[model samples]
Target: MNKPEAASIGLVKRARALAPLLAEEADEIERTRRLTPKVVSALIKNGLYKSLLPKNIGGFESPPMVFMEMLEEIAKADASTAWCVGQCSVVGMTAAYLDADVAHQVFGKPDDIAAWGAIAHAVQAVPGGYTITARWDFASGMRQANWLGAHVQVLEADGTTRMRPNGTPEIRTILFPASSATTHDMWNVIGLCGTGTDSYSVENLFIPDSHAALRDDFSALREKGPLYGITTYSMFGLGFGAVSLGVARATLDAAIDLARKKHSVGIAAMKDNSAVQGLIGRTEAKLRAARAYHFSTAANAWQEILNTGKLSEQGRAAIRLSATYTIHQSAEVVETAYHMAGATAVFKSNPFERRFRDMHTIAQQIQARDNHFEDVGKMILTNSVIPRGPTM
Candidate 1:
């Protein structure tokens, strides 16, 4: 409706302010796979989680690059915290695209409210609502969310999925309040302990029609405003990919610093070791290249959205594929940095060790690295293979 305060709040400046708080308790995050209450409170007070939503909701509605830049800063401080916040904030973006009434019902509670969940797991079709019996692992930020949005398929009375007029079944996302769902404590892992990305479920949860919405309807979004014209899920990919790139970039920076001070056993110091120098140099180069590819695609897409108002299905897929490639490439670079960190890092006291684990987890972020190669492979043959668009 009205211009938000996004222009006034410099995204980088706010990220710089939060880095110390995030770094101060990196160990705390490592221990819990979730951020400490203090860190969570600081994020809220700083308005860090609302960066993706429009300023009308007290958020920044910052440019896509802001997500990339800020995530790198946060990743530098604590990867797990960055991971959780990234996922949480993106969910808020997705919710903002729903019907205003639906948006309000879920994100309506308070100015600082956040919603969490994934669109990955598939739900079965049935009357009233889909019989959601899928295990959605890695539900980062689930611990702090007041609401969760899950993917579903419309079904007929006979338990068959209902097909649209185009002979395609409509896939929907259901927004369920946190109170109605049960959380599974399955997040114990080697990294990102503070993410609390445990399993959650809603057995036969009859989510009312209003809380659930489709992504394909354009007329509805036009009636609302320009904000809805932007694809919420694509924005999520931008934010999450930004998190991956940031962690990789931070890992490279940390390794280089460590190299400058320490020396190899035979050599004067790690900085003098040609081997270490090469490793760090290569890591830095790779991270930059990967980031350039990611941000450039995202920037162009956002600019296009501002100009043309919406993206073609192919355009959205291209951006998504770009993020997938970025995440995969960045993880490879971070792994190289981890190698430069050496055996001392395994002692657990080394900051580099925690980051190594964090970056590895970043690769496993469902939509990014781990799934990228396969998705892209599937996409190459999309015409004769995986059907494109929201249907697939």
Candidate 2:
């Protein structure tokens, strides 16, 4: 892959520098079920939120690998913050598909962040644009966002569901101010509590035509950059996969630290135990291998985009495979670390418990599901083209 620009390197450094603050605020973030204003302010101050925005529109449009590395670094400090950043960063990519004037109007501001979730209700396409009265769930990072988006199936004036050329229902993501929607406090969960992954409702909200964009549609893309060539969902897979790796890395490091200082009742110090040493060595190898697989896949796919100006079918499949595999592998490493930490892993005060919970939650997300392997396997078996879109 090509070298990342200076701005991209700066962003990664800023992410790393924010780690101590994120670690300090992790508990508060979880208690409040949202990022603190200070934390959000720091993120905005660092310009970390615009990691994937087009540079032409006062955005970074950072290299994909650089974006992944930044998220991984942040995830090491706080998975929820990293998760929220991942969600918002990818959501911001919608700017690439919107008209230049409209995109600038929506995302030109420094603090403009958007978050949306599972497509639920159909939106009526009006003469001017569309009117939506729908409720979406699992909108992460909405608590701190200035804008919210709804991915809905477009219904024509005749009350028919609009169809795309490929026979699927036409879906467009409509962006609107967060103030226009009623946010629900429904983010009760055991892990990644700081993400504030909650449900929200917008009633009879009128979205102008300029606010809607066909996400991940290459033909509809307005930006001309290799980064825009990749789909948003692919970026999510890469990012959240990195987040899982960060959680795994932190968990393992904690375990290693504990081993050196911790002692059992009847046995020697964990660090002195040959078995423990061997386990550490093996888990380290496992994590390194997973990280290698993940980054190498991303780098290869990025090189493809740089060379061909688009991500190929195989590139997408390989990314899905590597990302999903890395997430699962990372979870395994976290499990090993948590297990090695033994009873100490259960306490909230210690690092192992939250990371254990966060790792499992990451595995539960759509990007880490087992079915992704099946999808890629089918493609490999038939050598047939898979349907391309944000969801695929």
TM per candidate: 0.85, 0.96
In candidate 1 the C-alpha lDDT for residue 302 amounts to 65
1-392 per-residue lDDT for model 2 (tens digits): 34347777789899999999998999999899999998999999999989899887788888888899999999999999999999999999999999898888878988888999787788898888899898999999999898999788898899999999999988898999999999889988989999999988988989998998886789999898889989988999899989999999999999999999999899899999999999999999999999988888888888889898888877888889988999999999999999999999999999999898888999999999899999898886797764332331
Q: List pairs with backbone clashes in candidate 1.
A: 32-193, 33-193, 33-194, 33-195, 34-194, 34-195, 72-246, 262-270, 263-269, 263-270
What root-mean-square deviation over C-alphas does model 1 reach? 4.9
As a whole number from 0 to 100, the lDDT of residue 274 in candidate 1 is 82
lDDT of each: 0.69, 0.90
Q: What is the lDDT for 80 in model 1?
A: 74
In model 2, residue pairs whose N, Cα or C atoms come closer than 3 Å (at least 3 residues apart or on different chains), thus clashing, are: none
Please count the clashing residue pairs in each candidate, in the order shown. Answer: 10, 0
